[model samples]
Target: MTLRDEITNCRICAERFAATKTRHQPRPVPWFTPTARVLIAGQAPGLRVHRSGKPFTDASGDRLRDWLGMPPEVFYDLSRVAIVPMAFCFPGYNAQGYDLPPPKVCGQTWHDRVMAELPQVRLRVLVGGAAHRYHLGTKAGVTETVQNWRAYAPDTFVLPHPSWRNTGWLTKNPWFGEEVLPALKARVKEVLND
Candidate 1:
């Protein structure tokens, strides 16, 4: 079986997820192909994506697509883009109803292997702190890391999570829109067209 198959069949997080408020089963939404040139390294699936079995199907996804300057048709095309998260399933909600962080074991078990399958990836868009930590090995906070986007641009772009919760963050970080995004969009277009 392919690496994708192995991940889809994984039940390692079954018991742990059952303990969450959602008490959901493991539904790995591994969306990628070997031919993809752009890798979207996101945090994890949210409840909507978990239910739909598609990555980036929520409001956050809409924001992400806008960030990329991509439409759904282009964003969802497996031949050109690979959507690999730090975790594959929704980690569920905490006591306060905020999303729980992705289970670390998911990355430990599958990330390297999944990356190996996508050898053609020319651009990596790391969304959120978890993805930034995993892909860029940075100890910096999201704001700092994203502020230094030029350090990794044209190849990788580290972004804060595009969730509605970060609306305040977006307002505070106007440079993200005025500076990083134009360069990012150009890079994304260049890479995808290449």
Candidate 2:
């Protein structure tokens, strides 16, 4: 099946949304190109992205650009990067924090197919715990930490969420700036350069 078809038919996150206090309608269009070299696997959108319908189109986008040292022009280019967030829609939040989980339906319904379409994804950025947990499975844990990132290097990389809440996290994990930042840039440059 085509990427768009698989995404449109996703029932994973949608089911969870139905049970939430706030809900979001899903839009699985804008299937990205296979040439996309960077795959940003993030948590579902927030209230803002739900309204805008563009992935990482909020403050988080700004932080992500800062980390990547990329101008908005290059960062927003779908041809260069594919943004397949864990949950395609903004899966409303809870009082505790974000919420319980990103529907099993998303991975079960569409994730594999979408990844298949984007063969050029060289680096998959696992943003936030849910994205990391789902993508990395039991291999990732809260105690596992972003500090000892080498434990999960190369093909997969863990990142603090780009949300404002992570500014302190960015500060605490200075190595993310000193070490991971350089490597991430080099990787992006290599792909963008090519």
Candidate 3:
């Protein structure tokens, strides 16, 4: 079986999910292809993604496409883009109603194995804090890491989660829109085109 299929059919994650206090079933949602040049590495799937079994099928995805200056057809094209989160399954909600952080076990178990299949990836867009930490190691806080984006240029771009929960952060960080988005879109276009 292909590495991609093995990851998609992972029952280890299902067992992990079942053992969670919430006991929700896991539905791994990721897309990978040998030709993909851009990898959208974000946090875990949300309830919406779990229900649909499709990655980035929500408003955050709409905003992410906007950030990349790509329409849905292009952004969702598996041949050009890979969507792999820190955790593949929905990690369930906390008592406060926010989704819980993605389990570290999921990344520990699968990220390296799955990432090994995408040797063509040129741009790794690390969305949210968890992904940044996992890929870039212990760095400054998200804001600082993202503000220092040039340090990881050409190959990696740090971004806050595109969820509406971070809308206030976007408003507060105007430079993200004015300075970062244009450069991000350009790099994304270049990688996908190449």
Error of 3 at 134 (Å): 1.0
Per-residue C-alpha lDDT of model 3 across residues 15-79, encoded as one tens digit per residue: 66666566788778878887898999999998888899888889998998899898989888899
lDDT of 1 by residue, 71-189 (tens): 99999999999999999999999778889999999999999999999999999999999999998899999999999998998899999999999999999989999998899889999
The candidate maximizing TM-score is: 1
By lDDT, is 1 or 2 better?
A: 1
lDDT of 2 by residue, 12-60 (tens): 5565666676755565434367888888887766677777767778899
What TM-score does candidate 2 get on C-alpha atoms? 0.84
Q: State the weakest 10-residue window (summed lDDT) of model 3.
A: 13-22
Clashes per candidate (backbone, < 3 Å): 0, 2, 0
Q: What would the TM-scores of all predictions be? A: 0.98, 0.84, 0.94
Q: Please give the CA lDDT of all the candidate structures.
A: 0.94, 0.72, 0.87
Please list the Cα RMSD from the true structure of every candidate, rounded to 1 decimal place. 0.7, 2.6, 1.5
Query: Which number leads on lDDT?
Result: 1
